[model samples]
Target: MGTTTSGCCFPLRGSQAPTGPEVQLCENCKRLVLTEKEVIHMARTGMWEIEGYEMTDSSPDFPKLKESAENGCDFCLFLRNTLLSPEVDFDADEIPRIRKTYRDAGHQLLFHRAGYRMSIYDEGKLWLSFEIWIVHDATGDMELLPSLSLQDPPKPRVAPSQNALQSTTNLFLRQAIERCDAYHDKCKVGRDPAFLPTRLVDVRDENAVRLVEGFTIVGGDDASSSSAPKYAALSYCWGPRAHADQQLKTTDENIGQHLFEIPMKGMPAVLKDAIRATRELGIPFIWIDCLCIIQGNLQDWEKEAGSMHKVYGSAYITLCPTMSKSCLNGFLFRDPPSIVFPYHSLNGQPAGMYRIRFTRSWIWKMYLTVPHHPFAVDLISGSWVRRGWTFQEAALSSRMVLFGASATHFHCRTSRVTEGEDTETSVSLDDLGLFPLLPSTLSGDKLDEAWKHIVASYSQRNFTKHTDAIAALAGLAHRFHSLREKDEYCSGMWLSQLHEQLLWRRAMYEGISWGWFFNLLDPELPERVLLHAPSWSWIQRINIDYQYIRDSVLPTEPEDDGSDGHGDMSITPSPGLTDETLRLEWRLPGKSGDESSVVDRFMQFRGQELEITGFVARFPLANADKPLEVDELREADTNLFWKWTISGQYFCHTNWDFLSYTSWDRIDKGEFQHLRMLLLSSGRGKSSGEVSPGNAASSDGNISENGDVEEDDRTAFGLFLFPTIKESENGKFYRVGTWHSFCNGKGGFVRFLQYATVESLVLV
Candidate 1:
């Protein structure tokens, strides 16, 4: 190869293609940009590797190019943004040496016809490897490059054609639907909505939401007589300004006018984009919450809210503006600009010939990994996946086109596809969030896996109105209800697994302080939310975790109605318990009177408390490891971060300080034994030879302190109750927290049961 006067032995190509201003390239940096002929010739082969050159201390002043990077050199900028930068933990000082490149403290660059791979290594371990591949420029391949410095933000790298609709985006949508219809047998089953939303926006019109029955397709027949016309649904955040009267919303006064035509120019940007996308996809109607449901009309809102499951689930497809922070932010915003290397010719002459857009290291890092959850990568900077309402919308929909930042992501029950050259990375319905895609025939352990996964994920999300916590999940709960039609939804928990669901604990994370009694660290606890639901329910608080207890936890005892045993059933009676000793009765409001609607029935259920029959045992908080005197405990108040004790197996978790709940001077002996354990169910314990908890004390003289007893496999799960003036027919107690006892084969389980007094209590 001939070399340029600047020692730039590189090939360059010239074309009329628009690109950023040319950047000065060093002699060694010219190889980063390849000629069109070289790219094509190399593309014919499988792979290409180049080695031998190494820049070291003996090399020229490579650091001198930092000034060029700061001034705006693309080659230097790419180096500064990637390998040569110290942004990430592993920092590369220079390019890999010829011999040391394959070993420690160096770097390696792998090339292919399309693009290249850059790997950074330290101490003989691969620290980071990211790929930059060639992507065909399309009408929708519009993305904005990052600002070179704090002061200079670059313009859009690839602008869309003026009159061209996003053909690539439309193609992905059409292909996704076609593939689902043709190949996805699973996706074809039971996903069609039994009925459409009460109303839908006629996308072909600028603005209008009509009754689904009377809606007319744009270029097709009237939908009333035929199977409901397919419609798209818009899933975007309403943002804090959503409730402002300025937002375009369908109301009682304007309902008639809205049915005729909606003012599209005045609508949120997201709504406009959704309508545009739907119209381009040949869908005549789309359902938008603010436009379809009457705002400010309580009855209409509740009625429509109850049917949201069908609205999204039945839609032909859901248009998710994944990166949109709010309705105001349109989905068509430019993607993060990728690094582009202007192609060079064999003569070392450079021009805007081939503006090859290659991905940045950060973008590759974000999308390359299998996300821990649905939209994990999107959630890193976007608000769509973090909102509570959108959670179910994404899960319940039959198909979705997530208009992501860099590329469009398509999802159906059978497959997840991302637009671009990288096809290996895809989402799966088997992953968390797509709950409706799960097997409907799932039972027992499978049910636990599904429900627990949902709860854990949903708990971490933010809800605009705390009241919508359970309401938002009603649709998903209904789907779960279909698996076992006999089971009832109790606020958040199911009546079938009420006992196990009651065992939810406040999920601990790094930000929160969690330590033993002596190391009491107070977390910034939120003001206790007051809801009609019982404290035992997970709905009482967010950021909760649940333990999947088996049906074997049901005690094997006779029924109060004189039944012999729980026979030929999934839930068997444990060896030592009876119906009276361990029973649970759900008191729902609709059971007493006829409820006209599902919304009303669910509202009544959410407001009702749980009635449980179990054995009550008391444990003195005074026996805790860092026991506090009356004055010290009372002064600690709600801020007291100390934990209480149950048995020697482990330190028990309490929702609050039990010591502060009692009247210090009013107690008979000032013992502060206000901590009460109510055993709801029991099962065989996990076999172990571990020592008892430090605070463990024998409640009975007959119980042995030594590990001499037979293998007593009894594990009792229950709630720790605190006395409350709030009374009910059975008993008056509020749930402080939950507990499950472990058998240490040292008579600890027997002692726990011996201390129990059988009683019926209503938890509030």
Candidate 2:
């Protein structure tokens, strides 16, 4: 997604082909970019065409580009190259693998000089993959280099001796496990060594892998004061399966037979590789969720699932089968093209292929394995990162061993080392920015920021089970207990951060009907999701776009609800606030509370009489040209309301329809239920003429903790009025939109403002 700048956004791609070392540039355009500000300017103002309004060949710049194409410009030729152009910078051995990839997709892969980019072309669909690396040439001119991506798949390097227990990868695993042990005993860090998990699959030995008979929990500290088994956990995607796809499950009957029925060879590829790796690492046990948790038994699944945080966090190490799409897709693969490259000095002199240290990280030490940098490319780019379960697994574990298609990786607290790479390229762990799940030593206010970070990341990821929204983060949420007292977990929103947390929304996109997903209007996606949660909770509106919302500030802890578990769901105005900004004493319905009563398909603000206060006028929704029809918003000037609302898991609308933009952060607090959410616009006062918000033809809809909305001398704050529920009897309201006007509405709005009394209303 392209980023918004100032009040607008530019096109993500350029009108003409991009220029630089990595980017193809014709002789005429080579020195052209270094002198002009086109690139930087385009980045700010965006391309002449936005999403809804596209620029065509008639666009002034398009003629020049087309002429250049006809004139055979080098950059133009590169862009127009529809036929296969023989290209290569790789060693001879990689050709077969590259050809195989092309054959699999019926496409061709092309690599330009210095291996800057990989262009895949088949039919009319073309994708150019390149990571731009900038450099300073001898003339002091900046140059760019595109890094190519045909690295060989990682294969375990086994030791020469048949008696050797450790393969090259297993050696690093042993060191990571032992290093954690050393930290427990010697380091000043006050982490507990007794934090071992409650359950483990005790791989009998290097010769055998199976769970102990009738062994669910390894009876240790809870059963005795003695030590427990050190185990490794496997993290991989289950992937899309057949309609009736059924993996092995543990049930009451099968639980007793697992030891007898489950065998190493019978396991899936990923699990088998995990067992082999665990045995080779000299760890006596390993834990896999699917194999250990009884699938059909809800009670057993919940009990084991809820403890996943501790199981993963306390594990000796987490093995990431990064290359696999499913358990069926194993970690090990046939070695492809080599990662090592022939070295070239500053003077362009030929040097030997660059060497990489496999033994240092492979040999492990007492200090932490810090990440030197984020990986330029992550493993597989598959369903792994997309899975909601994987985030917690990756965050909770202090150590991980990633078996990727390109290379292996070792991650711990201090460092992240890639297989077959030198230290200079290693990523530092701090750059990963894992919140609340950060090191235990990192406590205090930063934890809140970390928690939000985790929430935002978790919100964007997907879950196979829409009901597992909270369950997926149950591990991290359980750990956040000390951050606040009990009753903090309200479905998905926190009681402490209730006010701001309610601001979450579904991600907005382009082309889809925005009206289909809202709580009111022609609610398209509303009927699709499960109703395990109240309408107000983010869990009910799963697959949110929380990351785009600005949450990068400390949270102001509101007064705790202080109610016991299963409290009442109601609302009241927060007291003692002098400013127009108001806080609400809104209580989310408890788990047992009747959501149908608290929230219906349509609900209303019940009070004596209502008058306009103020409505939010956000900045432009990502350079959208959608006309804003509402006006008279409080202090309206450059503020632009979101022009569209779309549906996914929640009511959503994006600026450029993809790249995220800031959304309004006001406390509607169930105020807009029943799809009565309004955007009141009146241009009664403003220097920039009468500026309205979104057009009445449509409807769409946060301050950071440290952020504040300052009152300016622009105009009287306008009241953006929206209808809550369209008064449906069944209590269901299809979300359509709101009404907007540059001038205050003559009839209802003016009469209400003049004759209406300030009446407090409770939405539910």
Candidate 3:
């Protein structure tokens, strides 16, 4: 074109322009046609430029990217989206696609945002630049780019050389050292800035001979230098031995591991099974006081006492060994909330069964050791409730954080003997007690008060007197029972089982006395006789008879063979003319035959009767002379009456003898009847023959020559007889009768009977 020297420059029409730079299209099109790699290089090198794009000092047209700057521009918008957004939130449909397209085309979208300017500069070529501003609608959503511009790049600033930067850094370090010295003089020895430095020097001097260390110091003029003081030291300053003494104390292997072993017997089978299950599950430790702590050492005990919570908390699992089926209904069997949800399949399918929620901690409070003193600080008296576990769940789920004892025997023993002593310790956590805390709950003091009331209501003696006490006890029992039924934390079955166990324990420890029936018998009787007696009558009649003979008739002095002074004849009855008549004779030591004679004199003594039904005996009077009266026994038409007789002056018949004889009759037996004959007397009473009824014998001729009558045997009859008649002395006897004949069914009747002596009654 130049060679042609034509004055006109012809524009190329459909045909492409020449590839040479000098022959390229106008500046605008040339800027747009540049390769993406060239454009990126221009932007990064700050070399892209355009003619007539220079700014004057007054214009200051460079864009500000900071949003806080007053003259913020589109460049700021690009900066904010590309570098400042804390989280990325690009336009979903286009951003990822555009990024991928650019990446595939070997071109990068350096930065792009709505209403923002993007630019590129070429460094290899004459400083050339291109810029664009994105346009957006009123809604603030982004739109396509609408305009572009080209600009010339500015010159670079002058800076110091590398060597100059290093010298300035050294000078900064020297100034920092001078400032550090001045600061050290103003502060105390330990608080001085020099303190750490001195310590570091000491360490370096000790270890520098053996160690090579490199370090960098920052100071003036270096790009990275700061005005702050610099620090330097040998590597040994930070070595392991520098603060070896400041390390934590080494733990002794036995510090918390010293355990006391206590052997236990008579553990419930259920508990044993639970223990076995726990062991099988891989639980390694248990802190049961009866099994883990020594019984006698106070120091050891205190140590255990202090660490009770830690022991329980750190346990992999606790075993609740309640054997009572009722315990299944209590709080110990509750289920945790985590297990309540249904299982979900990996494909988001719903599973049929609920998944079990397993937790690392299972607190068995009712069975765990009570926290004492400071140990209680972290323990709540009722931990389960506090942990958001309900009593019902506890009652249902056997595997729980806490467990309760089924039987009162174990409960009381564990609570009172082992844990009771620890109650004095302060508690701060909820897991310490038998139950956990729940919302709208009473404080510990209030709960204690409530517990007292609950306990009193259930007490046996209290209920026996006050009918309200029974109701109160029942109410409490039912309340707890209902909680067991309703709570998800434990199973109702376990709670119910616990109740049954407690009842049984109460019966064994505080209910009826089987010992009284057996222990008050004669030793001479066959063991079988005493052991086999199912009711109190057998004990009173057979065993008590011999017991009375030994206690009242036999002399205290030991004979030649170590037998009682009284001869054996005292125990054996002689044959009489009739089968119903029996006679016994014996001599008291130091007493004459006349004084011990049976036919000499007669004595009448007043006594009272007590009744025995089944294995239970009731004393109706405060003393023997008082009349026997039981409101429940007033309606019987006839009652069994056991009579007594004491004869000899020195041989006194105690009232207990009246209980030994087996006799009974209609209450209408003509005022008095000959109950028995007496043989001997010791001091205050007389011997008698034919100890007959005060009135004449009945016309039916029921009386025998020996003075006993074979009366109608329809009424209940049992005997406790004493033959030595004594006058003006009180005697003990037993009578089974009712005050009113018509109301016979008012009181229950005896269903069984057996007999044994007092000496045979002791518990082995």
TM-score against native, each model: 0.63, 0.54, 0.16
List the candidate 3 regions with Cα displacement exceeding 4 Å: 1-299, 302-449, 453-513, 516-764
Prediction 3 TM-score vs. true: 0.16
- Report the lDDT of model 1 for residue 497: 70
Model 1: what TM-score?
0.63
- Candidate 3 per-residue lDDT, tens place, 1-764, comes to 01111112222222222221112122222222223333345557643332221111110121223422233222233323332221111111114432233223332222222121223322221212123322222222222222222223121111112121134433432343343345423111111121111010011121121111111211211345333122221000000222222221112232232221111234333323333333333332223332244445555544443333223222322333221121112221322212111112223322222211111111222222332211121122222222211221221211122232111110110121112121211111122123221112223323322332222112311111121221212212233333344321111112112111111111111122222433333334554442321121111121111111121112323323221222221211111001111221111224345631211111100111121111222222222231221111122211112221112001111232222112223232322231221111111100112211221111112233343222221112122222112332234221211111000111111111111112101011
Candidate 2 deviant stretches above 4 angstroms: 1-166, 183-199, 213-225, 243-246, 334-376, 379-382, 413-415, 419-437, 505-507, 510-515, 518-535, 540-764
lDDT of each: 0.51, 0.40, 0.22
* lDDT (Cα, tens digit) per residue for candidate 1, span 102-158: 223323233222223222111221111123231222211111112111001011124
What global local distance difference test value does model 2 have?
Answer: 0.40
CA RMSD for every model? 13.9, 15.8, 40.8
Per-residue lDDT for 412-466 in model 2, tens only? 6544565434442222212332211344333444444455545555665567777
Q: Candidate 2 vs. truth: CA RMSD?
A: 15.8
lDDT, model 2, position 401: 79
Each candidate's clash count: 16, 55, 136
